[model samples]
Target: MIKKLTILATIYSLFSLSGNQTLYAQDKLEVDVGGALRFNYNLSSWKEGQKNRGGDFGYDMFRVNFNSSYKEIYLNAEYRLYSEAFGGGFLKQGWVGYHFNEQDEIQVGLNQVPFGIQQYNSHNWFFNLTYYFGLEDDHDMGVKYLHVDDRFEYNLAFYKNSEELTFGGDSESSPNRYSYDVVGRNKEVNQFNGKLIYKFGDSIKSRLGVSAQYGGLYNLDTKETGSHNGLALHYEMNVQNWNIKLQGMIINHDPKNLPGESDEILQMGAYGVPYEVASDFSVYTAAVSKSIPVKLGPISNLEFYNDFGYMDKKVDRFEDSFMNVTGVLVSAGKVYTYIDYAAGYNHSWLGGNFVDDFSVGNPDAKWEARFNINIGYYF
Candidate 1:
């Protein structure tokens, strides 16, 4: 009788281990949790006496990403817990799509717009002038198709409303800062973006691409309509341990009525500007970086980079602006840090938070300095 009981116990133990293995094989789900904490020590000065020096923090949130695959269908979702302005939490990216092989896919939801570059070339965390114009690091509610092969890579997208914008009013519930939109008055409608890049050469890898965007803005109050369109050309190359990138674009804004419109009325899209007529503008950006093979303590790599940007608004009484930045980047596993010195004149878009000249009616075009130390850690 004792021998019979031992045999039964052995059978039970083997079956339990086999069942656990079967469950693991049938339910193949992958989950990753990662986030970043960004801190900054800034000393910035703009107009005389308009200066501030202090510590700042941003995007300090925890994120969870989930993924699962069933044959040709793939699912992805991400959620974040961070600072909240409106009622609900912020949604960075969430999409479900079909994989047409390993190189192509189509996704629908909030995704990055394929405009100039996927991620602009800059060591500084603030990005370049294009971001201020709603072109860089800008994501919207849209449908996107992405394809990549040996010859070229492409992205085609169609967006709904131009994300939410804060409209007129000093009411405590202003949503302008949250959403990079106008005072809730002018909203972009029927927007489309397309980008394509072709790669060639074996030894010297080079890529060139052109991008375009077309959209319309509507003023809810006056029922006025405006149109915006632009074209951009970009080029990049990799040489040894150095990388070089360049991009140029032209953008135009055409409103229904120019001078006849309300003088002090809040204009949508373009910030700190009076829409007098159809104005054409241009922006040029360039950057170069070299990676040095040196390690210090926890630092695994060191890089030195320089970034420059220039903007020209072909309008009377409006002066052109330019910005230059030089910085050193340190990478230690999942942690990265940048120490930079930025100086510019009338370049409000490139200025740091405390050195902004956007509010000044007419900037004196005087050069100012920003000593910035940005540190970020990811897990």
Candidate 2:
């Protein structure tokens, strides 16, 4: 009887182990989906010379992620959908990744170039208020590798160049009107990036990284070629209640253009903020409640903060030149509410000679302003 009882217990233990293994295997294949919706109202002109004001509400992003692992092999897939103000849906990202070993992995599909911090900033809804400086939401089909270990991480990728479509005014256009292929247009672009992170003490840490890209353009129609280069410097530090980040970039556009064709600039910015607030519920009795606290839950769980920003740029003889200032105030919780205001002055320059002065006069640069309010929910 004792031998029979021992046999039953061993069989039960084996079944339990098998069940646990099946559960673990199931958990390895996981899928998730999420997205955001945004509504924007533009009380001012869209750009410099336009006279029409507008507003739009649409899906900001709809994305899904798939992760699976079998034995020593791993796989990942991500997809994103977006719509513009004019009403059309487009695929933002579609990518797949494979893991060969614990420390190395490769990905291919449409993905963002792993270049700088600004390219991947996650703090704000709109990336840095201006879309011109950083390569915002720009991606291409490519292959990437990631080597991650204890003290260092490296990312490298080569991707199919993206293409831009140009259209003619006020009518249906042919699919082959004018297309700019970023890859075929450029000779070859290779991006290299690395990060060095060190931890000193329990609460303080820092990281520094440098990234660069070099490539040339190839004109499919004209068979012309051009070169391009971009470099960035990034650094961040976290200490106690403060976190700081600094980034800078130097870019040369159309370097292969004639004597005055290329445009180059150096731009940089830094941000620092406290990690946490001292008071759970604090009311400021001021003219403008810079910090407002509203009960997000039974406990004083959530708070709201708002700020305004302004910038002005002045350049002559440039088609896309303008001077502008913008401000935004936002609140957060289960839902987000925000307001944006912007104003700008725009003008054009025409070449002329001193004596003859055979040049058209600059039109009165228009003054444009826009006010937008948005409410969104996320899960």
Candidate 3:
């Protein structure tokens, strides 16, 4: 099935490429390809009192993007490849669009669901700085419609997704059960999402967005059926050198399980004092990140940055799971290099229980500290 999907994507890409040639005389075609190399060192990998230290080095990503615009028509395609160790491989995105006028357009194809800012800026390393607050949603093959004006923009999308898993670990073996967020069986799922954004001239930029998805899970053997639903709210603001964003999500089940469990989540973050020290230098950029569990306590974190062109100075607390209170002060002239350090009390929280299982181990809570160094490039 994956191979067939890849072939279909290739065929679609060729079709779009050929269409670009005759779409419009004023149309333009563009292509982008880039990759990132990173080496990370873990100070503490052993649980609690054990000492298991190791590091990873590899190409984090390799991706190609194609975009074309012809008069009132537009098309885009992207393909990405990465190491299998990171659960990475190849995925494709293809979409075709038409502009009714300067401010209104509609697109239909395998496209992105406009649920979060980070989801739109996947190619960036920093991930727009807002993504760290946990608003990143997955992409889907679906139909989408978008409307954009001077100050207001809106997006609506519907998509379907399917997967097959055998709990016994053999590919040919049929699993005893099947489930999905929207449908009870390992069948196609119907998803719907919508977003609205309002920009307030130079003073403040704000957006209010909401999304709800519902469907059923079909059991293959017993033919049992289960239902699932997810709802979320997102808001963000940018004032001067300060930026703040908040998001909340409620799920009635695993969203992937036929008879999944229910869970709720809330996350928020803020950054301030983005000052420029020189023509290509900046200082005093600080941020705070927090997450509140539905029934557990809150996790507080902080991050600091001083970037100067190719060089950056960073210090923060537990950027993600398996990392804690890490700090890095590096100077990259042409080659990227940095001396990193960190210390924290715990690496994670929640004791790895039902909540972790429901959310797929997202928003991991851990406490620890470490130090390391590496060199890399971005082009």
Candidate 4:
């Protein structure tokens, strides 16, 4: 953050010294500052002790956002502060963009990868299972080009690498990040992404898109570069106030590891923790939601949604993973809340053990449930 502040100050000084007062006067800068404070209550079926002791409610996160623009140049960034156990503080995303007319633009710096869906594909707070695998809404340090028209949209991006933490010497990448990335002995680098979306229909609008990505997995132990690739087909449709989303994807990872190291699993880290994942897998997801407006005192509207995802491993003896979430979002002026009942089987972020749940998980593991409610006030 200090670095960003210094850069802004330097730019101001240079502009003032150049005596270009008219240049600034012609394009008055616009800025908007906002933030949110959130809290959560959770009760897990797997955590018998916590359930017996009457669940738990605590602070979730506090985030501040900035959106500023001077003519065709714009900047957007967000900083978040989580609890110490949840990775402390980090920059969620920061990017500078330039507009070349209405049809084209470019974004530079840490930005979202143009893969899977735009912005986000899920309706609930937990998102879909693809998010945990770093396939949905992942961000990295890179540059991207975007083109949009009435019927088509195109995105092309090249990421040099994932965001790195300078203070952690023992690991190649920090676990204290908002998005999951390849870590441990291998790091994600030199990634290329392309996506195309076609929009059609009138009253019942629909969008069909295809996305693909290829990247290098640099193995620290072997000092060699391996490869990984993914392809996805996604479709979204809206009829009346109902929304439907569907997606399928295939991914493969090949890493060069030292002798005796298994190649079937890779390490992925985020939120200040590391976990194992199947190197090769296929994912399928479907979701539906309905928006209804009501006059329930302070409650103005409600959105009911259900999201589901499945992960099938390619390894011969590996087990599959599944996740489902049913919830409703309540909106009352500046206050918003989500009430969710989420369940999973052989899922890492769910109920199973942390590190190996997505790797070679138990084939007979039973489904576990977690009931949660999250509330936030935005300003």
Best by lDDT: 4
Per-residue lDDT of 19 in model 3: 13
Off-target runs (Cα >4 Å) in candidate 3 are 1-25, 28-54, 116-135, 162-188, 222-225, 254-378
C-alpha local distance difference test of each model = 0.60, 0.37, 0.39, 0.85
On TM-score, the leading prediction is 4
For every candidate in turn, the CA RMSD to the true structure comes to 9.7, 14.1, 14.0, 5.2
lDDT of 2 by residue, 161-258 (tens): 44222322222111120111222112323433333333234575666676676655443334455555566566656565344545555544452323
Could you give the candidate ranking by lDDT, starting with the highest?
4, 1, 3, 2
Each candidate structure's TM-score, on Cα atoms with residue i matched to residue i, is 0.77, 0.57, 0.56, 0.93
lDDT of 4 by residue, 197-258 (tens): 99999999999999999999988888899999999999999999899999999999999989
User: Candidate order by TM-score, highest to lowest?
Assistant: 4, 1, 2, 3
Residue 6's lDDT within candidate 4 is: 19
lDDT of 3 by residue, 294-317 (tens): 321221222232211111112122
In angstroms, how far off is 168's CA in candidate 4? 8.4
Residue pairs of candidate 4 with colliding backbone atoms: none
